[model samples]
Target chain A: MSHLHSLKRHLVARYGAIIAITVLLLEGLCMFAIRSYYVNTIEQVLSNRVQLTADYYQKYVPGVTPLARAQKLLSSVDKDEVALVEVLDLQGQPVLDSDGFIADYRHTTPEVSAALNGQQHAWVGKSPLTGEKILAVAAPLCRDESRDTVGVLRYSVSLEQTFRVIQRLYIYCLLVGLIVIALVLALCYSLACRILLPIEDLTIAAKRLGAGAHDVRVRQRSQDELGQLAATFNYMSSQLDAAERAKNEFLSSISHELRTPLTSIKGWSETLFSGKLVDKPNQTQLGLEIICEETDRMIGLVEDLLDYSRLQVGHITLSLETVEINDLVTEVYQQLTIRLSERHIGLTLDLQQQLPLVEADDDRLKQVLLILLDNALKFTPPDGLISIRTRFEQDIVITVADTGPGIAPEDLPFIKNKFYKGNSKLPGSGLGLSIAQNIVQLHKGRLEIASPATGGTTVDICLPQSTPWTAGTYNWTSKANSTRQNLS
Target chain B: MAKVLVLDDEIRIRGFIVVNLESNGFEVVEAASGEEALRIAHTQPDIQIALLDIMLPGIDGIEVCRELRQSYPAMGIIMLTAKEQEQDKVSGLEAGADDYVVKPFSPNELIARVNALLRRVTLVEQVSSSSEELICDPFVLCVSEYKLYKGEKSIAMTPTELAVMEVLLKRSGKAVSRDELLDAVWGPDYFGDPKIVDVNIRRIRRKIEDDPSRPFYIETVWGHGYRWHGESLA
Candidate 1:
């Protein structure tokens, strides 16, 4: 949970801050537009009022004096509409003021000068009299016959009220921006929690798994990538649990296997060490022979363990050579026929003549045949039948079938896994078939084990006719092997 | 020479055992499976000692021990269990094996345990004929038939449990220490945990007493051992 604090901070800093800043910038743009609209309405109204007053003077109301005209035309100024109205002589100085004071209006500016030249103009600045902000508009007044400028009519409506409206809108915009920022931040926070909570759950599960809690699992909450991640994590944990169980089973069985030999070796060595056979050389020779056999049995089991580990890491290197399939099968058959006949189990061989030479490891291929034959021998009862057949096709195929009780349907799938002995009490470290499969696969071959309901088990080995024994074909690599193992 | 039966599926281990036992002046009968062992025992009543391995093919050693204890009450049974089978050791005892030897054991250790168990077994046979019926109220021990009666109602008992009941009944009203019971029932050379006495005693109380939790016939003497109250409780 503490690990999520930094993530939360990063979320707020990156995503939340970005949303807030964007909202603020939008609000500022809106406020500027609103202010311009409001101020422009005020300027338009003031300029229209002052221009109409000057037109009336030029056309109809003949001025007695500019001061008298301003006083008379004050009613047209519409005091509710414009703040102050003034008339100026041709000197561009105010001669009359709407505040009932003349010659007190202080400045002559460009607006009044432009109006004297018969151009209407407007400007906004601080008033000379009151120092208050105002928008002033001016227009030229001319004689009716001459159509020439005589005086200027100037009008102004103070901009103070417009500015107040703009200020209030700015406050409203900031309030809306704050609300928007809060909403987006809340959304970002929830999104972050939604994502991180599963990661956190996976982290704790992984920790418990590291601590050897095999059954630990997390809930799948959503259909996003995180959900897939959770599903994948559950799969990984289950696999680890199964592997752990398999390892424990292996330990127990291996210990039993090791002890059987040790019991023999220790018992005989103790008797031999006790000098019990001093008068009997024949008994001593039997003990020595049994001791040597038990030692070889242990070495075989140890070699299987070494081979299994090497296969896992892809470290087993095959010495590739061109070998005759017929000769190989015949050799294995000869080696095993003696044992088979001793047990009274019958054997038959069916061979395809003139088999093609394939690139393979001679010793490893022989090991595969040995494993399949050893299985057939273990399962087959006395006077049962065993057959070895070879076929030639695009790939050379060898099949070994036994008349033993066939494998159960449930046990068939797991036969290639290490140490899957399936309720058989016969003695062997169950690594033989698995190692054989790995070896055959390394030679561009596959081992297919099937048990038919008709009461027999058959193992088929198919090797490609020609796969060049190159470094690329067999990857003796660090990176590629790891990925392959992971995939397996 | 004492006769012994050595049962193991492994041929070399069986041969080793046969050779070792024969060298030590005991005649040996060997069988490779539980069914063969039972057949051999049936044929030869003189074989008084049996050593069975637990992980055989058809019937396990525990079940075989139960079968042997039922019919041959005077045969000394020893189980040869592997090291990882710690629970199997206790189960083997519960199934009426008198003692057990772990795998990879030295021959001397095995021979010592066998000699010890022989004393207890022979003693059972010797003591059975000395009495026809040993009775204390509702509980009656039938020696020759290897049975006990609760007021004409016969109850089932394994050989180990019967041995404990016999010892406690003979020494009724006297507080017998655990070591004395261990020596008398399991033999002095018993290379096993002494807790087998408690297990058997508890089993005995369950058979005789109406309420085993508060046993009246068999009384725990608190840190010392146990005493049979006899009719004193009645």
Candidate 2:
């Protein structure tokens, strides 16, 4: 049952309207062939009978009376049962008749008149006397070799014999055509299904991957396009599996690293508060200070882990708020001023005055900028130039450039990947750029990485300037809508 | 001082509980395991309240509660669970626990629940005195000393038990919430298990009636808490 359903689905998907049109085309071609064969055969048989009667007349009674000559010719030919032959005049009168017209001759038929007018013609119609279908053939008669018209020769044969032959041929052709069409359909369906089966497998594998099955692969092994697709799909699955394994290891290591410090901090803090360490005041104070520092470390590690996890699970819920983008950038700069000054990194802020408030999650944006700036500071050596530039070019563009060793062409592509620590010789969790990328994506923004011709990497953040502030309001007008637009 | 049984695996938690209860005028008997708890429950069958930790080593706290409830029907059983999940509370209550407290709970709150359960039970026991004017199931209360009499015999009840009975009689056939009782008896600052109301009700029923399983005057209302029926009052 399922096979039948899938076959129906396959036909609907692959064959569709093309099959219907092809069947109609084949049917039309078969009908034309059958009709042509029947008409050609009838004309050949009719002309043969006509020629034989004309021959009999010329040979049996060549110089005799036209009436008796025709009569004798008709009797001899009619005796053979080939046809009922008659001779008619121009005035709708039968001058000579074999079997006395046989009650089957119709004077009003086109074939009769055309014969009397010295024109050769043949047609199929119903006989008036027998009420049977017949084919009538009419040919003009000329005396000897002269072109003058005399009486006309009209001969008709019952179409039952020709029809019987045609009916048999038709049934045979129909049976053969149907068998051929069925074979073609079967072949087409099999070919379509073979091509689509691997695609269906790949679709299922993609769904499984989305559902967290990192090892899902399309394992079809034919050396066709679909097979190559399956091979590529398997490769992707392996890469994902490796990445997932590494992520799990990173999480485990981070958990252990954070938990050790947290355990010490919580244990010691509680002991000190409970007066267990009252005898060693100086040691207790130092322990308390160390606990505070470890707590901050734990917080930072947990924040990084959370950002990474959120990105992995695609569950970073953004609570967008309206804020001055310049103000936010300035605040981040001020917060990192000491570190920037220590590294002698120059901060350049070119803000468009009275710029419209940007709609974003301020905290997340700050985090992204902080990560980018930290990257810049780490990569740039002390006393080297680090420039943070902001502009409103078709959008709000923020670029952080540093004077450092340029990234290798190969490493540039994977710089934003989790745990991808490039040649900075700096110790980092390697989650900074990845988290920034995720946050930027969450805001529906873009992050571009450009390496200068000489050295250093320049990272640009672009956000849309024109956004709908309200249901029917633009960002520049209506302060209320501006608030909402900035929130977006 | 009322005899209280404390069961917990953690020594510090037990120590804190004992110190708090003792300071609040409760003579606490400590036990580390369910077996030890059962031994204590057997030796001191008159222990007013048994605080059993659900995650005890040997026979867990639910079993201990069941044993205590079977043997000493008047003893208040309050199970201690680590989390405040509904299933845990429901199961603990269904397993014949009069009340439950989620840890790490404040020692002061635990002591409050213990004191409330004791006071409520003693009041019900004391309410079974003479005075046929106020008829409540198989017990009669002497309105003068707030004493109770059950089948011509005087039954001892705590002051809180008498107050609860008085409130129920005043608003007979009405359902009351734990918050209402805490306001009326333990004052508004009472921050303890709301299951204290169930514990008190169970204790009161045991003291005044022949069978607490089929409580006549004080009836359970299932999910909405408890109700007192005037029709059940003799």
Candidate 3:
């Protein structure tokens, strides 16, 4: 019933009354045509029968017969041999009855009325009293030397046989029509729903997947269009899940990196403060220096986190200044000298003399360089050559190259992603490149990472050439050294 | 000889300042707080310099500096600060203090700054007292080097203790205290107490006095006061 209500809603929109009226009109026309044909054929047969009776009378009886006599003659004829024969007087009294009906000549049927009006008529309907189906036709008969209104002669053939034949034909046609309609409806419903179901399922499953439930899978039960859509959804979910897993792993590794340095600083500072190194000046100084360096490293990591977050939220405000790239590189190199020396990495400078000052933050640029140089030193073998080169290609290009183990081609694409490290071949916090890239981006600069032909990795920082200088780049190491020299 | 007073809570720091000042040829006096420095400044008028530490146990250095500067305009005052934060240094300088040096500072730097302050104060004092031949605290003298020209009676003294007496007689217009005598004659850290300070007074009195026991060239300041008994040079 609810389905019917919905269907009614659809049918109403496409003109329900017009469709019903058209169906009713077509049914009425069919009934009219069938009745007309039934009457015409019956009238033809009746007229021929009447004419044959007239011929028989004319040939066998060589004298003129009165109307009453003709009526008697017609009535006397064998009823079983005749389909239906009836005579009515001009005063409307039945003269002869056939098919065992006591005919009331005063009563007028449509066929009789038409016949009395000098037009022949016939009709098909159920019999009222006799309960036998019949087709009736009527016409006026005239007799005598002068034409006069005589009586009506009516004929009706038993229509039971025609009715049976038509009934059977209609039943067969209706059965075939119903079967065809049923097949069409079945095919339409299956085709429409078959095409629609998987799309529906895909939409539902995709919605669930979007809500972050990875276990949702579309059923690919067919080799049809919707099945292909389901397959695509499955592939997308799998890809998303893989990427999510990789991100989780990267976050875990970052946490480990953050915690390890923190643990070392905490543990060693406690040991140092406990006076275990009271007599050991060298050890005490080493411990203090290590604690200071580790604290700096932790602060750097936190700063990287802040920068990354700022970059993610697009909130970084660059304090741009005209900077000498070579000077900046030298500052970072000096700061990292202890580590670089320990790694036995010989830094060769190829700075362009009188290179145009590029617009950048000297400190932030130094930070970026430190991260990159630290990474290079970490991955480079002892006694490997590290080189700093500056070039101008419409902009300042500062490159730090080292003879370290080169990065794999696949890892290069993801090397700048947060906390993404290459398979732990070398130990790293994995934030160096990512932070460097973010800082470079903040300066409206470009960072390109590539493997040198000989070996190791090269990072190129390209900065714009026309930003303003807001402050001087003061190297703390140089200041301390100068103070020491002055004191000495 | 110029008299200097050192005020520091730390014994080692006080010794360090006193030793440096004495080596630079200034007569040095030591006090550990603003109160002691104030008390010493009130009685011993010969103090030429007052070095104060900004952080002190009681009556902080700035207050002592202000009081000393008010009482003795010729006295040089230096404030010592520990932190390099500009606020501390500026506060010390703004408190009527002469100069400030950050602590953990080099001893040479402190001495250099002290000597520079002394010269600036001395030069200003020289301009104000241009006609005065010698400027010393008011005190009486009985020494061999100079005759008392106060109405023409020449005072006499022995050469052995005469040099000691001369240091006091130069400041005869003011009270010549015991520590000043001890610092000039026997040297700093003389270990002997106020007795040697009294004994030196007795020895100077015997040669230059009319009576040894009741001599009145340099009068004893019992408890909290001292005076020159002969006469005022003015």
Q: Which ranges in model 2 have alpha carbons more than 4 Å from their true place?
A: A1-19, A33-44, A79-84, A88-95, A99-135, A139-152, A157-488, B124-189, B193-227, B231-234
* Residue-wise C-alpha lDDT for candidate 2, range A123-224, written one tens digit per residue: 788977578888888777766666666767777778787777778877777777677667767877777668677766887788899999987978775998
Superposed model 3: Cα runs more than 4 Å off: A1-87, A91-107, A142-149, A173-216, A222-225, A319-342, A351-368, A390-398, A425-427, A438-446, A452-454, A461-488, B1-234
Off by over 4 Å in 1: A1-3, A77-168, A211-213, A268-289, A307-317, A466-488, B1-6, B18-31, B35-50, B66-77, B90-98, B118-234
- Candidate 3 Cα deviation (angstroms), residue B49: 70
lDDT of 1 by residue, A1-488 (tens): 77687897798679978998799889978998998787777778877877788777767674587677767776555566546788787886778777767774545777887887889998888877667788888888877878788788888778887788889989999998999888888888898889899999999999999998999888999989999999999999999989999998899899999999888888888888888877788878888999999999999999999989988788777776778998999999899889888999998999999987877788889998988988999999999999999998778999999999999999999989999999987778899989999988888788999998888999999998865555236533345465766698
Report the alpha-carbon TM-score of model 2 versus the true structure: 0.47
- Can you give the TM-score per candidate against the true fold? 0.79, 0.47, 0.50
Residue lDDT tens for model 3, A1-488: 35534544444434444544555566556655675686577768777775555344334423244444455557556766547777666554566656545466463567777767766667556656467777776666665433454556666677888777666655665565556555555555565556566766777787898788976788997987668878888898888887888777766655555544453455455545656557767766766676676678678767777777766665554555667787887777777777667767788778788878776767778878878887878778889888889988887899989888788887888888877877752335577788788778766679999985566898899887763342334322223334655688
Docking class of 3: incorrect
Give the alpha carbon lDDT tens digit for every residue of B147-222 in model 1. 7899988876655666777778788788888998998877777767787788778767777889999999888999
Clashes of 1: 0
lDDT of 3 at A76: 56
